[model samples]
Target: MNASPKPPALTTSRAAAVWSLIGLVLLTLNLRAAITGISPVLGELRDAFGLSGVGVSVLTTLPVLSLGLFASLAPVLARRLGTEVAIAGALVLITAGILLRVVPYAPALYAGTVLAGAGIAMGNVLTPAVIKRAFPRRVGSLTGVAMMLMAVSGAVAAGLAVPLDHAGGWRLALAVWAVPSLVAALVWGPLAIRGRRAAAEPTSRPDARGGTGRADGSLLRSPLAWCVTAFMGLASLMFYVLMSWLPEIMRDAGHAPATAGMMVSIMMFVGIPLGYLVPVLAARLRDQRVVVAGIGAVMAVGLGGLLVAPSAGWVWAVTLGIGIGSAFPLAYTLLSLRSPGPSVAARLSGMAQTGGYLLAGFGPLAAGVLHSATGGWDVSLGLLLALLVPEIAFGLLAARPTYIRLGPAPLVEAKEIVVPEPARAR
Candidate 1:
């Protein structure tokens, strides 16, 4: 009897690489659809569910809170399960959650939201690490591509939600989004299996960033890391607030329901091209402080415009879109740029996203509470304006050309094995 040959080592072929990129794009597309899709049909859902203002706010807040709470688990899962496998699991969770949300029960809806959000949070933290490992040389371009797709998908979901709800009611509208997650999972599963096989094979190459153990602990003490966290958190707070309430703002200003939804879409659509462009540019720059300040200025101007004259909603939408689109990718880009290597990138991403989303989760709830208390949008808008100060300040600090030093420097001896001679010289 002859011995059987071992299977060939796993390698990424050109076709396979293309498929992986496509899978990533598809995955990015699903990240926000489940969250943003609900906003357009929120009014209908409120009526159908008999929800009060706070209940409506919670509908948006719970998923975002889940994103933050679950993000820290990604690196742990990836270490235990392999990155690709973890991502596949996330997709499954997303699909299941999306399906569960349409079950016509409040508990089911919230549970589904939490499930889907947890899944998305895993993908959010790991995507940068995957890109860092797979496309080190083209991080900017690939990050741009992923961010652009994210914006495009979010825009489409927001724009189409009301119409889809009209066509088949809110349940169908929300449930139909699960199809994309299912498709992405089908596309990604084989890739994950291949990755698992490759990882199982032994290699002599040093782990990226030297070692992954306890190195991330240093980030807790690094001022730069805190700055990055603040910037990410505040930006997210602003974006999610707009996403949750922009349609309502438009409608309150006298637009029809469909038009109001489209206005939100317009804001998101304007960000798509800028999302692709901003990261590429930010990556090439020496220091991103100027760009950060510029984006902040744009957001401030747009928010002021909306507060004063929302009837010209398109103008404000375009401005706000460009500001957010540029700011978001730039923030994500900094996660990779400021880190020394992929492991550090993963840690930074996890920290930024965990803290960021946790803070962001409060934005919608606070806005709802303020509006309820004041019976107007003025106080809510004012709060957003106040947040911009910290965002811009921290963004500038985080944008500086510096890396988070993970551990203390090695000790150096001025004189070795010459104590007597050194004392004589002294």
Candidate 2:
């Protein structure tokens, strides 16, 4: 019997690659616009709709919880439709969900979020694989750049939504975001067409083995895989907590609502450039442990400032922003860096995010509950501080220059694996 033929290479001209990067940035920009945009408007919506704190928290929680389930279904959807088509369809669902808020009914509001979140979930899980497949040599750079776009869009939407809502209604503010989504869809529409054309060609069939395996039992057995999963999970938990509670945290410190919202936006703003910068730097480093520790230190300092010196809050927010911003993209970059191939990247991304965001979903809820219990943000921030310890430890493990070594190959002789001591210290 003949050995199986090697897969065809992903072919895109340098110009096409550049264009795809641009498209990726735009697509990423839309992913969180609807979600982060809503965070600023939550108070307005809650009052208008007669929602309780728990009710609003439920609204916030549902999308992230749904993301894991939606992500599980994404591979199937990608198989049924081409990947680009699935991504495009997700954008349409997001647009429809945003539009649904025009009615402002409780059911409609919640329903729209679910639909919109589904779109975000697919984009979140798939974009890394797409980036890796399309820009193999520049995974770190592209992941950083794309995540930067996400941070920028999120900050813009969070900061601007209130002003937009005041000028136009919340309905208009919510729906106006549909323009960017539509624009991204339009930009990506051509790429999808190009991909479909390419995919339909006989030459393209060689690349179509669904390269990675399913996120099945064997994946759970891998220790390195668990490290990646934990790193992704803890990082996401930190992110969602800030996104969900930062503005309120600022408000409690006595800032005006608008100012607090802007402060929250500012924290995310510092992350935008770092999102692009950190990954490029990290990729060149021998080990990412130093970077991980440095970022964690920055985060600790920023959080400590918030707890100790409420007067210098703005400065601390900027510091926190840099720390969190860099950390977020780094976490995303790890998904690709740790995977053996595009197939594995896809599978691991789905698994990591499924477990990761489920862990993340609890962060803000726990923060809110802790605040209610203790009557302050101190306990909440303290708890987050404790969580960061493990994140730093696992991030160091993940940051090391090695992919997840699978179980012994069938025909190859067994050899002792070189387990790094630093990773074990974590």
**Residues 1-426, model 1: lDDT tens digits:** 988654342343566767878888888989989988887788887888788887876787788899999998887888777778888899999999999988878888889989999999988888887777666556677888888888778777876898899899999889999999999999889989987887788863443334332344557877888898899999998888897798888888888998988877777788889888887777666578999999999999989988999899888888888888788888998887676666667778888999999998888878978989998888898888888899999999998867676666311121211111212334
| Clashes (N, CA, C under 3 Å) per candidate | 0, 1
Q: Judged by TM-score, which candidate is best?
A: 1
lDDT of each: 0.81, 0.77
Give one digit per residue, the lDDT tens place, for model 2 in 1-426. 989654443334656777787778778988888987887788889987999988897887888887876876665666556677777887888888888876758889999989998888888887877876776667766777788778778778877999999998789779998888888788778778887887687653211222342233355766666778898889888888987788888888888888887777788777888988887776555567788999999999988888888668789889988888887688888777776555566667777888888988988889989999999999999988898899998988777676653454211111221222322346
TM-score each candidate. Answer: 0.84, 0.83
> Over all chains combined, what TM-score does candidate 2 have?
0.83
Q: Global lDDT for candidate 1?
A: 0.81
| lDDT for position 303 in model 1 | 91
